[model samples]
Target: MAKDNTTAGIIVRTYMVGALFLLVFYGVIFYNLTLYTEDRNSEKRLQLLSEYYSEKYDLADFDTIQIDPLLTIYGDYSNLPDTLSAQFSESWVGATTFHIDNDEEYSVLAQRIASASGNQTIYFVEAIGSVELDQVDIILFQSMLTGAGIFLFLIAAAYITRSARKIGGPISSLSNQLEASESDFSPINLSGHLPDETKQMLSSVNAYRARIKRALHREQLFTRYISHELRTPLTVIKGSLSVLRKSGNDKTLKHVGLMSTSVAEMEELTQTFLLLAREKLDRDVVAVDEQLVDRLLENFSGLIQRNEVHVTRVLSAPFSLDAHPQLFSAVINNLLKNAINCSLGGKVSIFLSPERIDVIDNGVGLGEKPRGYEGFGIGLKIVNDICDKYGWMFKLEPNPSRGCTATVLLK
Candidate 1:
C-alpha cells in the first residue's frame, strides 16, 4: 500500500499524535490529583482521631489501643507495624501509606502530644481499603477518559478532514486546469473561497500564462517576418535559375539545376519553420504517398550521387497522417538527409508501413561523423518536436550489427 503523502494526511496524523499526548498528559494529572486528595483526607481523619483520643484518655498510659476495627493507635514506635516502624524516627511527623497484603492498605500518621510527664509521640494506623480507589474504579475511570478522548478525536478528525479538503481542493483544481490546458493561454477560473496561499499561486500561474502567450506571439511575428524577408531573394534566385535553364548552354545548366534545388530546399525549410512557429495547426491531413517520398528523394538525388550512397525504399502501402504537409515533409526530409549523410558511400534504406516509418543506415552508425558531416543537429530536434506534438513515438537505436535505425511510430 502506498503511504499518504498529501497535505491533509500529514495534518491529520500530526493532530492525532498531539491529541494522544494531551490525553496522556491530562490523565496523569487527574490520577495524581485523585491520589493527592485521598492522602489529604486520610491525614485529616488520623489527626482528628488523635485529638479526640487525647481528650478522652491518657496519652502515656497504654502502648497500643484498638479504637475501631479499621483504626489502631500506638503510643510508641516499638508497638507499630514493621512497615510503619521502618518509616518513623523520633522527629518524624507526617502521614504515610503502606500495604500489609495484596489487598490491604493502611494510612499511618505520627503526631506529638503534650502529657503531664513529658512530650509523647503517638502513631495512628488507619485501614483505608474502602477509602482508596480500587483497581476496577481506576480501570473504569481510564476507560471513560479514553472513550471521551476517542470521541473528541473523531469529531476533531472530521473537522480537520473537512478543513483539509477546503484547503486542498482549489490547488488540486488549479493543477488539473494547468494540465488540461494545451494551447489555451486564458487565465484559470476557480470558483470558491480560496486561501491566501492559493490566491498567490493562482496569481503566479496567470502571470506565467501571460508571459508565455506574449512570447509565443512574438515568436510567430518573428517567423512570419523572416519568411517574408527571405521569399524575395528566393524568388529572384528562382527566376534567374529558370532563365539560366532556358539558356542553350549545357555547361551552366547543371549549375542552374543545383541552384534551383538549393532554392527549393530553402523555400521548404522556410515554410516548415513558419508552420512550426504557430501555436496551432490548420486541420489539414497530408497523404504519405510514394509521389511525395519520390519528390523528396529526387531533391536529394545530387547529394546521393555525389556521396555514392545506395538508397532503397519499402513502401508497403500508402497512408494518410493528420498533419500539415510542410511539417510532415520536414520530418521525412530531415530523417532522410541524416541517414544519407551518415551512410555516405554506403547503404540507406527506408521502410514505410501503417504503423511506422523506419530509416535504417549501415555506414558510420551513431557518434561517428564523417568529415564535413554535422552531427544530427536542429533537424532531429525538429523531428522530435513534431513527433511530440503529434503524440507519435520517435526512437533512434543502434542496429545489432552496424549503424542505427530511426523509427517513427505513426499509429
Candidate 2:
C-alpha cells in the first residue's frame, strides 16, 4: 500500500487518533462518575431509612411492629434473605445494594442493638426501582455524549483539512514556480501573505539560483577563451606543416605528414570540446556511416598500432541520429579509443545497427585492470555525458569469456 505522505493526510490522521483517544477517555470517566454517583445516592437513602425506622419502632417490638411496604425489617440476623444476610455477615455498620431472588435491586442496612432483652440484630431493606431507570438514563446520556463527540470529531477533521491546505499552500506554489521556471533561473515570486519561514526558504532558493547562474556564466567565458586561444596555435602549426611539405625532403616530408595528422586531430578535439561546453546542443541530423567511423578510427591509428589491436566493423545498415556532428563524433571516437587501449593485442569489434552500437573488446575485463587504467575515467565520462544529453542508453559489462562490452542504445 502506498503511504499517505502529504501534509493534509498527516494532519487529518493525527487529529483522528487524538479525537478517538479523547472520546474513549471521556466515556470511561462519564460511566464511572455516573456509577459512583448512583452508588452514593443509594447508600444515603438506605441510611435515612435506617434512622427513621430506628426511631419509630422499639427493638423488643421490631418483630411484631407493622412494616412499611417499601421497607423489610428483620428482627433476627438468621431471618434475613440469603443475599442480604451474606452482605451483613461481614459488618453490621454499612449499607449496600444487591439483587434479591426475584432480581429486584435492594438497598440493605444492618444494625445491632444492646438492649434490656439481650443483644438484637435488625436489617432494613428497601427496593430501589429508580436504579434501573437511572441505568437507562445513563445509557441515553452516554449515547448522546458519543453522538456529540462524533459530530465534534467530524468538525475538527474538516478544520484540520482546511488548516493543512492553508499551511501547505505556499510550499506548493513555490514548487510550481520552480517547475515552470526550469529553463530560466529567475527569482520566484509569491504572495506576501506567506509565513516567515516560507519567505526565508524562498530567499534561500533565489540566492542559490543566482549563484548557479553566475557559475555557468563563468564556465561559458572560460570555454570560449580556451577555444579561441588554442585555435591560433593549431592554425600556426597547420601553416608551418604545409610549408615543410612544400620543401619536401623524403624524411622531412614523412615527418610533416605525421605533424599534419596530429594537427588535424587537435583541431577536431577543439571542435568537440567547444560543442560539449554548450548548454544546449544544435539539433542537427548527422548520418552515422562507414565514412564517419573510418575518419574517427584514423585519428586513433597510432593508439591502435601501439596496442597491436585488430579492429573490425559490422554494419547492419546505415543510420542517422539527431545530435551535433562534433558531439556525435567525439562519442564514437572516445568509445573506439577506449576499446583499442583496453584490448592490447586482442580484437575490438564494432557492431552498428539502426537501434544501437556495440563495441566489444577482448581484453582485460572491467575491474580486472587497476584504477585509472588507460582509456577509462575521462574517456568514459565524456561518452556517458554525451549519451545522457542525447537521451541515449549506454552500458558497459564484462564479456562472458575475456574482455568488456560497451553498448550504446541509440533509440
Best by lDDT: 1
- Collision pairs in model 1: none
Q: 1-411 in candidate 1: lDDT tens per residue?
A: 886556766777778789889988988888778767777788788878878887887777469989888889888878877765665576788787765556767888887877766887788889887768976898788889888988998899899888877777887788779989968899998999988888998999999999999999899999999999999999999988888889849879978877888898889888888888877788999887889889878878889999999999989889888988888888889999998988878999998887898999997888788778855578889899889878899999999998899999998
Worst 10 residues of 1 by lDDT: 81-90
In model 2, the runs with Cα more than 4 Å from the true position are 1-143, 157-159, 242-257, 282-302, 312-325, 349-377, 387-411
Candidate 2: give its CA RMSD in angstroms. Answer: 6.5
Estimate the TM-score of every prediction.
Answer: 0.62, 0.64
Best by TM-score: 2
User: What does candidate 2 score on TM?
Assistant: 0.64
**Cα lDDT of model 1 overall?**
0.84
Off by over 4 Å in 1: 1-154, 186-196, 289-292, 372-376
